[model samples]
Target: MKDILSVKARLGLGFGSLFLLVLIISAISIFSLSDANNRFFRYVDGIGKRKELSSELLLAAQQRAVSARNLVLINSSTVRVDEKNIVNNAHRKVGELLRELTASVEAMSPGEERVEAQRLISDIQQIESLYGPVALNIVDLALNGDKDAAVVKINNDCEPLLRKLVEVVTKFIALEEQTSAANVMHSQDEYELQRNQLIAFCLVAAIIALALTLVITRGLDRALGTEPSILSGIAQRIASGDIRAIDEIKTARPGSVLASFGQMQASLSALISEVHNSSNVISGSAQELSAATEQTRMGVSQQRLEIDQVATAIHEMAATVMEVAHNSESAANAAATADQQAQTGGVTAKQAVAQIEHLATEVSNTSQAMLRLKQESEHIEGVLNVIKSVADQTNLLALNAAIEAARAGEAGRGFAVVADEVRNLARHTQGATQEIETLIASLRNISEDAVERMEVCRGLTDKAVLQISDTDVSVTAITTMISNIQEMVRQIATAGEEQSAVAEEISRSVTRVRDISDQSAASSEHTAASSMSLAKLGGTLKQQLERFQI
Candidate 1:
C-alpha cells in the first residue's frame, strides 16, 4: 500500500505541482487585473457621485437665488404701488410678502448657494434698508403725522430707487438660471461617460482570465507521464550500482509502457555492464530544460525592460496630465477674473448709458428752451408787424393831412411839406419794421428746425443708450457664463490630471504585466513547440525501444 501510494504520489505530485503553478500564475494575473478594475470603478463612481451632488446642490442654490430675486422684484413693485396709492393695504401686503420671502430663503440652506447668493441677498437687504426708512417716512406722512410735502417727497424719491432695485433683481435671477442649467448638463454628461468606461473595462478583464486557465492545465498532464519512466530508470540503475545508459529513456514518449520497459531494461543492462556511471543524455535533457528556462528568463528580462520603458512613458503622460490640470485651473482663474472685469465693464457701460441718457435729456431741455426763445422771437415779430401796421396808418394819416393842407392852397404849403416829410418818416419806419418782422420770422423758422433736429438727435441718443444698456446686460451675462464654464473646466481639468496620472500609473502597471505576459506567452509557445519536439523524439525512441527485447 505504501509502495502504491509512493508511485501514485510521485506521478500526482509532479502533475499537480505544474498545474498549481499554472493556476497560481493565472490567479495572480486575474486578481491584479480585478484589483485594478475595482479601483478604477470606485474612483469613477466616487468622482461621479460627487459631481452629481455638486450639480444638484448648485441647481437648488440657483433656483433659490432666482426665487429670492424675483421676490425682491415683487417687493419693489409692491413698494412702488404703495407709494403711488399711499395705501395701508398695499403696505401690509408688501410687508407680509417680504417676510414670507425672507422666511423661505432662510429655510433653504445658505451654504449651498455660496457667495453669489449671499451677494444677491445683500443687494436685496441694501434695497430693503433704503426702502424701509422711506416706507416709514411715507407712512408717517400719509397718516398726517408729517406735512403733505413729506409724502410728495417720498413719492418722488422712492419710485426711481425702487425701480432700480427691481431691475437689478431681475438681472440676478436671469444670471443664476443660466449658470445653473449649464452646470447641471455638464455634470450629468461626465457621470454617464465614466460609468460606461468602467463597465467596458470590467467586462474585458473578465474574459481574459478565463482563457488563461485552460491552456496551463494541458501542459501539466503531458509532463507528468514522462517523469515516472525517467525516475524509474534512474532508481533501478542506482540500486544495481551500474552506470545508466539512459539515452533512449531521455527520448521516450510520455505515457508509453513500452518505452518505460525499454528504459528499465536499458538501466538493468547498464547495471550489468558497468558499475556507477549514468548516461550523458540525462545531462543533455537537463541542458535542454535549462535552455528553455534561460529563454523564459530572457523573456522575463525583456518584459522587465519593456515595463521600465512603459513606466517612463507613463511618467511622462502623468506629467503632461498634471500640466493640463494646472492649465485648466489657471484658465478657470483667468475666466473668473474676466467675469469680474466684464461685470465692471457692464457697470461702466451702464453708467455711460445713464450719462448718455442724461445728456440726451439735457439736449431735449436745451432744444425746448431754444423753441421757447424762437416762440418769443415770433411774438416779437408779431409786435413788430403791429408797429408796422400802426406806422402805415400814421403814414396814411399824414398823407391825408397833406392833402387837406393842399386844399387850403399857399397857406397850407408849409404844412404840406411837413406832412410829406412826416409821411416819408412813417413810411421808412414801416419799411424798417416790415424788414425786421421778416428777419424775425426767418430766425424763428430756423430755430424751430434746429429744435426739431435736436429732438431727432435726442431720440437717436436715447435709442443708442438703450442699446448700450442691453449690450451691457448681455455682456455681463456672457461673462458670467464664461466664468462658470471656466470654473467647470478647471474642475474637469483637475479631475483629468488626476485621472491621467492614475492612467499613467495603470498604464505602467499594465505594460509591465503585458510585457511579462508577452514574454510568458512567447516562452509558452516555445515550450509547446519544444514539447512537441520532445514528443516526436519520444515517438522515435519508442519505435527504437520496440526493437529492443525488454
Candidate 2:
C-alpha cells in the first residue's frame, strides 16, 4: 500500500496532538490549583482551631485564679479550718494551668504570647504566702454560713490580679487569629490567578486546532484531485504527435507532485513526435535516390556520343597525309629520266660544229682563184691591139719618103736631099715590126700563170661544203630526244592520282571505328555518376534511421 501521509495530513495530525496536550496540561494545572485551595483552607482551619483552644484554656485559668484569691481572704480573718490544705489545693490548680499555657504557646501558629501567661502565674505565686492562712479561714466561713462577708472579702483582695490574668489570655488569642487570617488571604490570591490562566489557555488551544483543521482539509482535497489532471486533453494531444503541448505544460504553475507528472507526460509526447519526423525524412531520401539514379544513366549515354565525334576527326587527318606522300614519289622518278637524255644530246651537237668550220675554209680559197683569171685576160687583149697599129704605121712612112726624093732631082740644087729621105724611110719600117713582136710574147706568159692559180682555189671550196651539211643533221636529232622525255613524266603523274583516291576510302572506315570506341567510354562515365548518387542516398537514409532508440 502507498503511504498516503501527504504534507497537509501530517500538519493536521500535529495540530490535533498539540490541542490535546495543551488541554491535558490545563486540566493538570486546574487539579493542582484545587488541591492548593484545599490545603490553604485546611491550614486556616487548623490555625482557627488552635486559637479557639487557647481562648478556652485562658478563660478556665482566670476562673480558677479568682476562686483561689477568695479562699485566701476568708482564711486571713480566722484560722479555724485546715489553712495549709486549702492553700495547697489552690497552688496545685494554678501551677498546672501555667504549664498548659507554656505548651499551647509553643504549639500554636506564631504563638509567642504564652510569656504573658507565665508572668500572670508568677504574680499569683507572690500573693500565696500572704494569703494562704486567709484562704483557709475563707473556706471555714463558707462552710459555717456567713456568705456575705466571704463574698465581700474575695472581690476586694483578687480584683486587680484577675484583670492581669484576662489581659495575658487575650494576647494569645489575638496572635493566633492574626496568623490564620494572613494564610487565608495568600492562598485565595494564588487560586484566583491559576483559574484565570486555565480559562485563557483553553480558549487559545481550541482556536488553533480549528484553524489548522480547516487549512489541512482544503489542501488535501486539492492534492487528491491532481492524478486525473496529469492525463488531461492536452496530454492526449501530445501523445498523438503534437509538438506544441510542451509549451502549454511549461506555462502551467503546478503546485503538487501531480503537476510534475503532467510535465513528464509532455516530454514523452515530444519524444514520440521527433521519432515520426525522422521516419518521414528517411522516406523522402529513398525517393530522391531513385530519381537521381535515372538522371545519371541518361548523362552517361550523351557523353559517349561526344567522345566518338572527337576520335573520328583525328583518323581522317592521318589518311590525307599518306595520299600526298605517294604523289611526290612518282613525280621525282619521271624528272630524273628526262634530265639524263638532255645531257647526251648536248655532246653530239658539239662534234657536228667542228666539221662545219673545216668546210667553210675550202669555199673561201675557190673564190680567190676566179678573181685572178679575169685580171690576166684583160692584160693580153690590150697588148695585141698595140702590135697591129705599129705594123701599119711603118709601111705608110716608107712610101711617103720615096715620093719626096724623086721630086727634088729635076731641080739641080737639091739632088742631095732626095737621097737622104730614102735611107730614113727604110730604118723606121724595121723598128716598128720589132716593137709589136715583143708586146705579144709578154701577154701570153701572164694568161697561162692566172689559169694555174684558179685550179688550186676550186679544190679548197669543195671540202668546206661537206663539213657544214654534217653539223646541221646532228642539231635536229638532239631536239627530238628532249621532247620524248617530257611526255613520259606527264603519264606517270596521272597514275599517282588513282592511288590517292584508294587511300581516302580506307580513312573513312577508320573514322567510323573511332566513333564507336568513344561512345563506349561515355557510357562508362554515366554508370559511375549513377553509382555515386546511390551512395549519397544510402548515407542520408542511415542518418535518418539513427533517431529511434529501439
Candidate 3:
C-alpha cells in the first residue's frame, strides 16, 4: 500500500484525515455544550422552582385552615373581622400557587414524567377547590356568631378536605423531588459521556497525527534511500570527478535514490578513469603536435619576413618597370615615326630638334621627380613597416592553415596539405601586403610631386639649344637612339608582367590562408591558438568556456 501511493498522495491523505477528525471533534463539542446548557436551564427554571411553589401552596392552605378556626373561636366582631381577612389572603395565596403550578406542568415536555407530574398537580387542584370554599364557609359561619355551627363544619367538612388537599400537595412535592433528582442524574450522565467522548477523540487524533508523521517520514526515507544531505554530497562528489566514496552509497535500501546513485557512481568511476587515461595519452600527442605547430609558426614567420622584403623590392622593381614600359611604348611609336619623318625634308629635321628639345625637358622633369621621390623617401620606412605588419599577418594565416590541419579535432590528416599550402604561400610572397594606408600616402605624395614635375617639364633646357642644329647630322643619331629605347621598353614590360603574376599568386595564397584560419576557428574553437596566430596576422581572437561547479 505504501508503494502503491505516491509521496504526494500519501501526504494529502494524512492531512485530510487529520482535518476530518478535527471537524468531527469540533461538531461534537458544539452539540454537547449546547445540549448540556439547555438541560441546566430546564432543571433550574422548571423542576426545582415548581417544587418550591407547591410547598408554598401547602403552607398557605394550612394557614387558611388555622385562620378559619380562629374566626370560630373569637367572639369580638373586630377580631372575627381580622380572622376573616387573614383567611381570604391565605385562600388567594393558595389559588395563585396552584395557577403557577398548573401552567408549569402544562409547559413541560410531553412524556411519562410530565403526565405523572400533571396528574399529581390536578389532584392537588381538586383538593384545593373543595377545601378552599369549605374553609371560607366556616369563616362565614364564625362571622355570623354561630360558633357551634362553625365548629361542626370544621370537624366534618374542613378537616377531611384539608387533609386530602395536604396529602395531594405532598404527593406533588414528592413527584417534583423525584423528577429533580432524575434530571440531576441525567445531567451528570450527559456531562460524563461528552467529556469521555472528547478525551477519547483527542487521544485518537494525537495517535493518528503521530502515525501520519511516522508513515510519511518512513516513506520519504525509503524513496531517497538516504538523507537529503547525504544524497547532495554524493551528487557533488560525482560532479567533481571524485568517485572514491561510490561504495558508501551501496548500503542504501534497494530501489532507493541512493541506490541508484551508487550504480551511477560506479559507472561514472569507470568512465572517468578511462577518460583520465585517454587524456594522458592525448596530452603527449598534443605536446608533440604543439611542438610541430611551433616549428611551423616560426618557419612561416621567417618566410613572411623574407617575403615582405621581397615584395618591397618587387614594388620598387615594378615601379621602375612600369616607368620603362611607358617610355618604351612611347619610344616604339617615335621610332616608327623616325623612319617615316626621315623620308620628309628639313621640316622633319626641325621636328627632330624639337623632339630633342622635348626630351631635354622630360629629363629636367625626371630630375625634379627624382628630387621629390627623395623627399617622400622619409615616409617609405613607415610604409615598409606597414608592409612588414601585413607580411606578419600573412605568415600567421599560413601558420593557421597548419594549425587547422593539426587541431582539426581528429587525426592530423590535413597536416601535409597545410604544409603544401604554406609552401605555396611562400612561393607567392612576391605580392603586396594590405598596403591601403601606406599606398594612399605614397600616392598622395607622388601625385603632388608629379604635378610639380609637370610644371617643371613645361620649360625647355638651355643646354638643348644650339647643339643639335644640323638636321642631317642628328637624324641618324636620333634613329639609332629611338631603336635602342624601343628594345629597352620591351624588356621592362616583360618584367612588369612577371611581377604582376607574382603579386596575383601571393593574393591567392593569402586568401587560402584566411579561409583556413576561419576553418580552424569554427571547428576546434581554438581561440587561444587563433589569438596567438593572429598576432602575425594583425587580428585578435578570444576564448571562453562555460562555468559548471557540479
Candidate 4:
C-alpha cells in the first residue's frame, strides 16, 4: 500500500473499498433475484400449466359427454347439427388440452415430479381416447336419423365411457394439483436458501469493508501526523485566506508531515511581500492606463459618431440611386413601347402611301376615259347635222316632184299621191334630226365639264400620293430615332443599376466599418474597466497578504 498523503485520497480509497463491497453485495442480490425469478417462471410454465391443462381436459371431457347426449335427444335437424358441432368441438378441445398437458409435463425438469406428471398425462390421454370415439359414434348415429339407435348407444357405450373418463380426468387433475403444490413449496425453499446466502455474503462484505476502513483511517492518521479535526481547521483557515495560520502550523508541527507546508508558507510570505510592493506600482500604472483608455474611448466615440453619419449618408445615397434605377427602368420600358408603336405607325404610313398612289393612278385613268367620252359626243353631233342636211334635200325633191305631177292631170294624180307621201316622210325625218342634235350638244358639254373635273382630281391625287410618300419617309426616320432612344434608355437603365449596386456595396462597407468602430469603442471602455478592476484586485491582494508574518 502506497502512503496516501492527501486526506481526500485516503478517504476516497476507504469509501471506494466500501463501494466495491456494496457492488459485490448487489451482484449477489441480483443473482439471487434472477434465480428466484427463474424458479417462479418454472412454476408458471411447468406445474402451473399442468394444473391448468388438466382442468381444461376434465372440463372438455364432461362437455363432450353432454354434447353427445344433446345429439341423441334433440330431434330437429338444425338442433341436431348444433349438438353435433358442439360434440366435435369439445372432442377437438380435449385433444388439444391433452397435447398441452403433455408438453407441460415434458418441459418440467426430470425428477419424481416429472414422472408423476407423465403418468397423469398418460391417464388423461387414455381417457380421451376411450371417450372421444364413443361420443363421436353416438353423434354419428343421431345425425343419420337413427334417434332410437343413438339413445341405445349413448346408454350402452357413451355413459360408461364418460364415467370412466370422469374418474381418470379427476385423478389426473388431483395429481397436477398435488404436483403444483409441491413445486410451490420447492420454490419457497429455493428463495429462502438464496436469501440466507445473500444475508451471509452481505455480513462478510460488511466485515471486510469495516476492516478496510479501519486500516485506511489508521494509515491516514499516520501520514497526516495530526488529528483530522486539526487538519480540517488548518485547511479551513487556509481556504479563508488566513495566512497567519501558517505560522501557528509551522510552530506546532516543525518536523511533522506539515514540513512541506512550512516551505510553502515561506514561499507564500515572499510572494506576498513582492505582491505588496507590486500593488503600489500597479496602482500608479493602472491610473495612468485608465486615463489613457478613457481618452481613447472618447476619441473612438467621436469617430463612431462621424462614421455613423457618413454611413447614414451613404445609405441615403444608395436609396436615391435605387430610386433612380427604378425610374430609369420605367423610362426604358416606356421608350421601348414608344419605339414599337412608332415602327407600327411607320409601316401603316407606307401602306397608306401605296394606297394613295394606286388611287392617283385610278383617278388619271378616269380623266382619260372622260376625255374620250367628250370626243365621241362631238362626233355624234356632226352625224346629226349631216342627217338634217339629207332630210332638207329629200323635202325639196318631194316638193318638185309634186309640181311635175300637177302638170300631168290624172296621170299626175297617181304620181302626185306618191310625191305627197315622200314629202311627209322627209319632214318627219328633219324634226327627229333636230331633236337628236340638241340632245347631243347638251351631252357634249357635260362630257367636257366632267373631263376637266377629272383632270383636277387626278392632279390632286398625285399631290396626295407624293405627300403620303414624304410622310412615310418621316415616320420611318422617327421610328429609327425612337429605336435609338430606346437603346440609349436601356443603356442608361443598365448604368443606373450598376451604380446602384456599387452604392449598395459602398453602403455595406460603411456599415461594417461603423460596426468595427463601435466594437473598438466598446472594447476601449471594457479595457478601462478591466484596468480599474485589476488595480482594486492588487490592493485586495496586498491586504490579504498583510495578515501573514514574514
| Per-residue C-alpha lDDT of model 3 across residues 280-300, encoded as one tens digit per residue | 333333443454465456556
TM-score of each: 0.26, 0.30, 0.41, 0.48
The predicted structure with the larger TM-score, 1 or 3, is 3
Q: What lDDT tens digits, residue by residue, belong to model 4 across residues 1-550?
A: 5552576777787788788888978987998789788877777666566667777877878888888888777777667788778888988998888887787678878888678767766776776677688788888887887888888888888788778777876776677677777778878898898889888988898798879878887876566667767767766765556555355464444445665555666677677777777666555656556555666776676667667666766766676676667667676766767666676666667666766667677676767767667776776776676677667767776777767776786677667666776767676677767767676776767676767767676766766676676666667666766766677676667667666766776676676767767766665665675576675666477677666555
lDDT of 3: 0.72
Candidate 3 accuracy as TM-score: 0.41
Q: Best lDDT goes to which candidate?
A: 3
Poorly placed runs, candidate 2 (over 4 Å): 1-12, 66-158, 226-550
lDDT of 1 by residue, 370-487 (tens): 7776776776776676676667777676777766776786677667666766767676676767777676777777677767767766776777677677667767777676767767
Model 4, runs deviating above 4 Å: 1-8, 143-152, 228-257, 265-550
Candidate 4 weakest ten by summed lDDT: 245-254
Global CA lDDT computed for model 1: 0.57
Looking at model 3, the pairs that clash are 392-536, 393-536, 393-537
Q: Which candidate is the best by TM-score?
A: 4
RMSD of each: 29.0, 94.9, 59.3, 42.5
